[model samples]
Target: MSDSLKVGLPIKYALSYRHKPTADIFFPDSTYNFAPFELVSREYFPTVTNPKGSLDSAIYTLISFEVLSVQELSLPVFVRDNLDCTRVFAPIDYVRLQGTISASGEMDTMSLKKDTQVIPLSQQPNYPLIFLFIIGLSFLGVLTFWFFGTPIKRQIKLFRFKRRYDEYLRLFQRLSRATDDKKKGLENVEKAVILWKKYVERLENKPFTTFTTKEILDNLQDNRLSDALREIDATVYGGIYSKTTASSLNILQELAESLYRKHRQVLVQST
Candidate 1:
């Protein structure tokens, strides 16, 4: 490559390695020098930022790891970062690349227009690259529920949780309306509790639903559900509760609202 055609941000053609989602090494297309990846998660959308609280113009990669000791497994981690397409491409040879008009547009491939400068893969690294060098990265690491376990096994659990939230919302809405049939309304509330217990049993990776009303209420106490759950227990075990059947419905709807709000908060923070 000639120094005259020096590389910098916004290169002509940008190329990077992509590995198979399941394993670590590059797969058979072998044509792309791809690698296999163990997807602890497929929903990851990692981002990078700068020291002054501004995001870097370039994208970067950071490897997140947790070294746990029986004494202290959780520690601060600092390490090298991931590839930056803009900066990483600057030095590479790009004979043909669909061009970029502005700073934020996608990097596309165009027909080869000029003579190509072929460089051996081994020699490409001589150029400049921006990498992440950290002292401890684990502090900012968002350990998906998968890293502690496996997504394959936990997928059903997550699905059930999402569905239960939706169902709880619907059931609560149904309960909010005034129902003259008090007995049937209580029955509906009971079923909603059943549905919640079943979902919590799965989500907590335990038999929570089987824990009886008292036990379930105890477990959910810290989760901002104590009052509502107590009311639910009163309805189930006692002949009746202080709140009317419609009020019980209100409690159910309110509990669902609180949980869904929390779940959304978690998802937003994660993204």
Candidate 2:
């Protein structure tokens, strides 16, 4: 509504009756009951500031609008034909741009203002929902697993058994160093083997008591360990004979230690 909006056509016009353009943004209807605003650029509304007190700083004039649930802002823009109007985006609460002018010679046009009510559409999806069932099922599965599957246990390793096996391996080294005589050495070796079988039986939770000679030889492993153990039943029971020597006993003890260490290493690696 300022006089700056008006201009004059050139006498015998060079550009054929051109007019200057003017624009202003408003907060609400012309009842002047709401905040007044200025159009900064496009739809970005800069507030029409007023000092609240004598020594106060400027503050934005906030406006409230009652709109439907599914609503968005629509702005009614006004401009002369030659002047380019860059359409602007606005927030959900915004209403309209009204104070526009067309300036020709003595043509100060205070165009009547009208509001562009923003019909609120959903800020969410407009159509029917999909994949909701999938989401619900996933939640259900998680809850079921939490309540039931969490308590159920699967197969697990027995740590104590593994530790005992390691101790047995070390025991072989300790006991062999204290061992001295040859025939007595073989006797000690047989007793140590019996202790080992008992350890395995307890660890494996199986009844391995009173094993037969054929059973021991059948389960014999081809490691350095099997020399005295596997050969024992074959030598004593099967009438197969050989002289037990101090050198042989030392060699057998070393072989047993090597085999026991190797087997314990396998168990440790697995753990």
lDDT digits (tens) for residues 78-124 of candidate 2: 23245565433222242332223533457534875768999888687
Q: Estimate candidate 2's alpha-carbon lDDT, on a 0 to 1 scale.
A: 0.42
Off by over 4 Å in 2: 1-158, 182-187, 203-205, 220-227, 230-271
The residue ranges of model 1 lying beyond 4 angstroms of the native Cα positions read 1-164, 175-183, 202-206, 222-227, 241-245
lDDT of 1 by residue, 1-271 (tens): 1111111222111123332233222112213211111112111222333343322121221111222111111111112235421212223222222223454866565853776899667645433232332313443343544364454345555576578777766654564442444666556667667765565554456687678656766665444356666666777667474545455546555654665666655554442
lDDT of each: 0.44, 0.42
Candidate 1 has a TM-score of 0.32
Q: Which candidate number maximizes TM-score?
A: 1
Residue 147, model 1: Cα distance from true site in angstroms: 22
Question: How far off is residue 146 in model 1, in Å?
Answer: 21
